[model samples]
Target: MQIVILKDAAEVARYGADIFTTQLQRKAGAVLGLATGSTPVALYQELIRRNQAGEVSFKNATTFNLDEYLGLSGEHPQSYRYFMDQQLFDHVDIDKNNTHVPPGDAKNPITACQEYEAKIAAAGGIDIQLLGIGRNGHIGFNEPSSGLTSRTRVKTLTKATIDDNARFFAADEYQPHLSITMGIGTILDARKVVLLATGENKADAVKAMVEGPLTAACPASALQLHRDAVIVIDLAAASKLADIEFYQHIEAENQKLQAYLASL
Candidate 1:
């Protein structure tokens, strides 16, 4: 687990974009794992900018989104499909057919989950995975008590996640109670992973993910065991860390730390 305390969210976004650009340059047509949330909005914008500038090309790149709200059609405004099209897929040169989002409204969601995981494997797995932590430390809707080796499956949203995500819908009642998400095991299979967090609301969960014990209760803590995961956070989100200064010092010392480092 390596910690990067960026000065602000914009800087974090820039750094993330740089990572993707460099990776894509080194390995064209990379398979990417994407996360959708306010946390990644700026990063997506940065990538779009790079695409327009011809500094990067996602023409052949493949994307696999982390999760999607169950019971919502792809055309639904609040659906992950709609969100990705609006925020990223629409702006880039990525082949529309190369992008994959788990079927949110599949009648047999369990089969859909298995097929999603299989498709990722067939594409050679993800080269880099982007993640956003839920307020309760869930990743890809894999809430507490979720098995570490769980595969893609349907998940019931915790009340807290529902409340946090409610702002996207017309009303709380519009929020889907279930979601289809990649398992923690699936995420760990990526060659590299980047988890981003911002704002004071994320402070406690960020701290727990960074410094607390690796327990199922805080699913994000599983990153501690991953060999290739980087956590980029803004100052506010990192505020609760017991050794913020230490993290800052390390970042200052090595601006080019590898994507992963042993857990601190």
Candidate 2:
């Protein structure tokens, strides 16, 4: 696990974007696991800017989204698919057909989830999975108490998740009570994971994810078992971590070492 504490959200986005650009350059056909929510919006925007500037390209990339509302169609404005298109996909040169999101409105959700997992396997698994920590430490709709080794499946949303997402919907609109999400086991399979968190609201969750014991009660803590997991947060989000100073010192030394290695 690597923790990067940035001065603010914009700095965090730049750092995250640099990682993506490097990955795309190293392997144009990389399979990317994507996440939705306000936390990743700035990172996506930075990627878009890099693509526009000819600094990076996602043209050959394949993307699988983390989750989708169980009852929403891909065309729905609030759906994860639509969110991807509006936020990142449409701006990049990537082929629309290469992007995949769970078929939220599939007639047979069980079969659809199975197919989603199969598709990811066929694509050689996710090269890098992007994530955002929920206030309650949930990841990809895998709410508290979700099985730690679960796979791609349908999951019921917790009240906390519903309340957090409510801001995205109109007061008159109905929000789905369920979702299809890639589970903790599936996320752990990614070759690399990059989790982003911001704002004071996420401070406690960030602390728990990086410092607390691994437990299903805080689903994000499952990342502790991953071989390669990178966590990036702004000052506000990292404020609650008890080892914040030590993490900062390590980051600074790592930066120096990386620069030195590159110079050689």
Candidate 3:
């Protein structure tokens, strides 16, 4: 696990965008694992800007979203598919046909979950996966106690998660308490993973994920086992972490090492 603490949300987004920009530069046909929610919006917007500037292209890219609300069709305004369309996909050059979001309205969610995993396997797995941590330390809706080695499946959202997301729905809006999400094991299959968090609200969760024990109680902590997992956050989000100075020093040394190697 690599921790990168930046000045603020904007810097975090730009840093995350730089990773994606570099990935696309290296492999235009890269298979991407995507996420939704308020946290990743800025980074997605930055990617959109770069795409418009010809700095990166997703035309040959394929993407698989991490999760979707059960019972909501893709066309629903609140569906994750719609969220991706409005935030990243519509603005980028990615082919709609190459983008896959779990079938929220599938007749058989169990079979759909297996199919989702199969599609990912067929794409050679996700080259890079992007994530946003919930305040409760959940990743991709894998709330507390979700099996660390679980695969793609349906999960019932916890009350905390539902409350945190309630703002997205109107008072009378039908809010789904169920979701289809890629399990922690599935997310770990990606060659690289980038997780973004910002604001003071996420400070506790960020700390738990970065500094706490590697247990299922904190689902995002599973990233600790991944060979390449990057956690990017702002000062506000990183405030609760105990070893801030150590993390900063390490990042600085890594920057120097990377620069030296590039010049060699």
Candidate 4:
């Protein structure tokens, strides 16, 4: 696990984008696991900029979104599928057919979940997974007390999660009380993971994730057992982390080391 604290959200986005672009550059067909929510909006925008400038290309890459509202179709504006299309896919040259989002309204949701897991395996597993922790320490809708070794499947949304997502819906509109999400076990399979958080709202969650014990209570903490997990946050979001200065110092030293090695 590596903690990278940056000056602000924009810097966090640049750092996240660099990680993805580097992965795609090294492996053109790398399978990318994506997440929805505002935390990654800037990172997606940065990737689009790089694509437009010819600095990188996602034409041969495939992507899988982390979760989707249980009853919404891909065409629904609030669905993760639509979110990805408007935010990243429509602007990039990637093949639309290669991108996958769980079938939220499938006739047989159980079977759909099974197929989703199989599809990921067939794609040779994810090379890198992008994540954004919820204020309650949830990841991919695996709320508090969710199984640590759970798999892709239907999950009931806690009241806290529903409330957190309420802001995205209109006052009188319906909001989903269920979702299909990849489990902690599935996410940990990724060769690499990058989680980004920003704003003061996320400070507490960030602290718990980085400093808290590995427990199902904070699903994101499962990353502690992952071989490679990188957490990037801005000053506002990293405020509650007791060892913030230590993390910053290490990041600075790492940069200097990389530069020294490159020059040699």
Which order, best to worst by TM-score?
A: 3, 2, 4, 1
How far residue 20's Cα lies from its native spot in candidate 2, in Å, is: 0.6
Model 1 ranges with Cα > 4 A deviation: 256-264
lDDT of 3 at 113: 99
Per-residue alpha-carbon lDDT of candidate 4 for residues 54-75, written as tens digits (9 for 90 to 100):
9999999999889999999888
Superposed Cα deviation of residue 207, candidate 4 (Å):
0.7
Predict model 2's lDDT versus the native.
0.95
TM-score of each: 0.95, 0.98, 0.99, 0.97
Writing each residue's lDDT as its tens digit, candidate 3 over 9-50 gives 999999999999999899989999999999899999999999
Q: Who is ahead in lDDT, 1 or 2?
A: 2
Q: Which stretches of candidate 4 lie over 4 Å from their true place?
A: none
User: Which numbered prediction scores highest in TM-score against the true structure?
Assistant: 3
Score residue 221 of candidate 4 by CA lDDT: 88
For each candidate in the order shown, give its overall lDDT on alpha carbons.
Answer: 0.92, 0.95, 0.96, 0.94
Question: Could you give the candidate ranking by lDDT, starting with the highest?
Answer: 3, 2, 4, 1
Model 4 pairs in collision: none
Looking at candidate 3, the ten consecutive residues that score lowest on lDDT are 203-212
